[model samples]
Target: MILASLLRPLRSFRCVLLFSILIRIGLIIYSEWHDSRSVVKYTDIDYRVFSDAAHFLLNPGPENENVAQGPLKSLLGWKISLGNPYTRETYRYTPLLALLVSPNDWSHPSFGKYLFALCDIVNGILIYKLLVNVILPSSSHNAASQPPNKTEKHASGPQHKRDELSRTEIEALATTFSAIHLLNPMVFSISTRGSSESVLSLFVLMTLYASLTKRWDAAAIMLGVSTHWKIYPVVYGVACVSALSGGSVGSTSWHLSLVNQKTIRFALLSAFTFGILNVVCFLIWGHPFLEETYLYHLHRLDHRHNFSPYFYFTYLTYPPLVKQPLDSESLSSWNQLMRSPLTSFVPQMTLALGAGLYYGHRIDDLPFAWFVQTVVFVNFNKVCTSQYFLWYLLLLPLILPRFHVSRRQAFTYVGVWIALQAFWLGEAYRLEFLGEDVFLSLWMRGLVYVLGNCWVLVELMKAYS
Candidate 1:
């Protein structure tokens, strides 16, 4: 009778939890609807590029614009605007995303944004599932072993036999973790926009999940699709190599290991598949796709102190040479300087890759996929904006189950990120007090950006080390 009474309340509590989750999902859907109707405004420069690419895809362009700038751009153009031609300087590198969202043009931009936002919500759910299914399993097992009641203890049995987790525990942990990801302000902000990052993140997480399950074929396909969306996902292949090489069978050292035959085969297959696709794109579109999509990244020089330590070197050593506003006749010099790598403060991207490889060996264990990805990303030569937090966020639940920072520390880190976002979003409270000095505002904002990313990097280094 006593046990039955206790079980009744527990069952009621579970029911309430399920109800709350359903309510939250409903709220998220409603919020997305409200946000979508808010506006069709560009929050960043990349938005313009993506929007232009969408237009180009739906309407063919002249020879200048018709030439493929990237695989995605070419693919989207072929899909949306088969015969007609259009021309614009605002061509983008990511046309696949535009293609995916193109079907919704009949509705307002809000509808498209809402669709993407829902995708983000789905991504958050997947992250939570990974945390429960992949990361928190061991923790849940541990928790299950220590029972509070005699009946619970008897039911669980000895510690040696307590490897499996209960469904309830798994669901609870998943729900908690999922909520964290769902409410993440950065994710919310980006998903509400029509950019590809949210979709890219979803694919990346799916790849990680597939890889964790040792479903190499599925993992490879997911990764291939992910890379098609954003080039950065290609680095994940290197991480896969590192993971498979860490075992005892073939080579003792990661540098020389070729242990797992299955993993090796899968990696090779993925590489071949992506390579073939690239070749096909090349054959279809030729040089424009190669130059504008692939090579364009090589020359991008954003004037901001991004997360990489290299940004500090560029900002401090060689400031960007801005030309005074002038007539069109004098524009050639400006363009020449902008295109010159010698004048630009390019970071040593190669060195960063080498360094990441070195450190990754020290930190990554068993399923080294996420660890290797995080290490490589942190060391990349280019700027690491706030949205790139998704890279780390996806991996954290996988790699850091045993690790626990204090609640205070977690809150402090979140607070810093919020402050940094405020500055980046041009909502700096300090700016309100400081008035119209552009230099002061820039300096203050830049400092916050540098510090926030640096703090994250430092935390990552410590965690991995």
Candidate 2:
């Protein structure tokens, strides 16, 4: 019995998941050691930022009375705290994240790293469920990219109807998805670097899973939690609402039906959940809650050493000029251009909204639709980071099985992504680390990044269409 159990196919998933998790843990330890020794290690400043936040969370100190006075006072206190070496950080993440990391007792960085690694494990399990329940079940054998086996064809008979996946096939697909997620290079890099994107990824996956299962109330709360953590998931909420209400696909135009009972309940539940969380945070942390978390992002603009396509445009127009940092005053012209209604923000928002509407039209395979919508959303985002790639990369395995692709297209896609990333990294290394900012090279790098995304978007449109 023991031997038979060990040889079982289902057990393969267990073995794979365990191995993947072990590898991630090893990577986290390796990264910590690497960062300690090397100035140009893989870890970003985010690790330090989060550490500072985590430290502040445990030791908010006697500063609370001052912080509670007003947003201005709170900002001033935070600014003052920054100058002090001992207790010098304000929390920018949601309280839930602070609470999640608080159990480590502000003891060591390992606690947070371990917590993130554990979240990756949970994400692996969630990916497995997403594939089994949503992706596998919804696919028709005829519609699958691969041709059906002889047994499958026989089962369907002369009428040639599609056959459901067998239990064995379903388990295999689930295990495959779980492995891809757990062993993903991007996921490993993010988790090892102690980035909170892992936590965000978990809530986002839960939101997708809950929505796909028709658990509207749960979906709403999860969406609320995710959005409160990082603002981008709010874009997903639009897709969530549309998926719940259902959409008309065949036509060119699409509309959201707010009158639908499901949509109404989802909206109210989500708003209440999100509002309550923020209100509780306000009562406890006061004005600083909004100031540090949400408002900070509104004012935040990173024109230097970023991968955004718009970065080079601002650089060319504003010209940070040879190691001299571009001040806020200098960027005012670029900012004005970006904020203009006819340019920048409006077009990106319109494209994202249109993509969401297009994806929502599907009633049977909403998960795949949701994945496509997320890809579109991230691709067009105002700011694109390597870490942000995790958002849709995690979802691709679930969606890829549904589409048929030729070798040429696949090669083109992978080549485009890698080539673009490689070029950007090479230039970024020179500009950031080597202190060589060849002004023209920066423009070329940004153009390559933009073109790479455009190439990717075109491929996605071809595949999904």
Q: Give me the overall lDDT of model 1.
A: 0.55
Tens-digit lDDT string for candidate 1 (44-158) = 4454455555555565556544544444455566532331111335443534555565544444444455566667766766766666666566555654465454433322212
Candidate 2, after superposition: displacement of residue 81 in Å? 18
- Expressed as tens digits, the lDDT of each residue in 1-465 for candidate 2 is 998775464346888788878888888788878888998886657666666655565554564422233333455543322111123354567756766665455466667778898888898889888777776666645444445455443232111234566777777867866777887877877787778788888998898888778787899999888888887777776666667656565533445353488878888888888888887676556656777778765544445656665665555444334343335465566655653324445655676656665676554455555666566566655566777778878787676655545556667788888888898788888887788966568657867787677778667666652
Pairs clashing in candidate 1?
Answer: 60-84, 60-85, 60-86, 61-85, 61-86, 68-289, 69-289
TM-score of each model, in listed order: 0.67, 0.81
After superposition, candidate 1 runs with Cα above 4 Å error: 1-51, 61-88, 106-111, 139-165, 248-252, 258-264, 304-381, 415-465
Candidate 2 residue pairs in backbone clash: none
Candidate 2 lowest-lDDT run of ten: 79-88
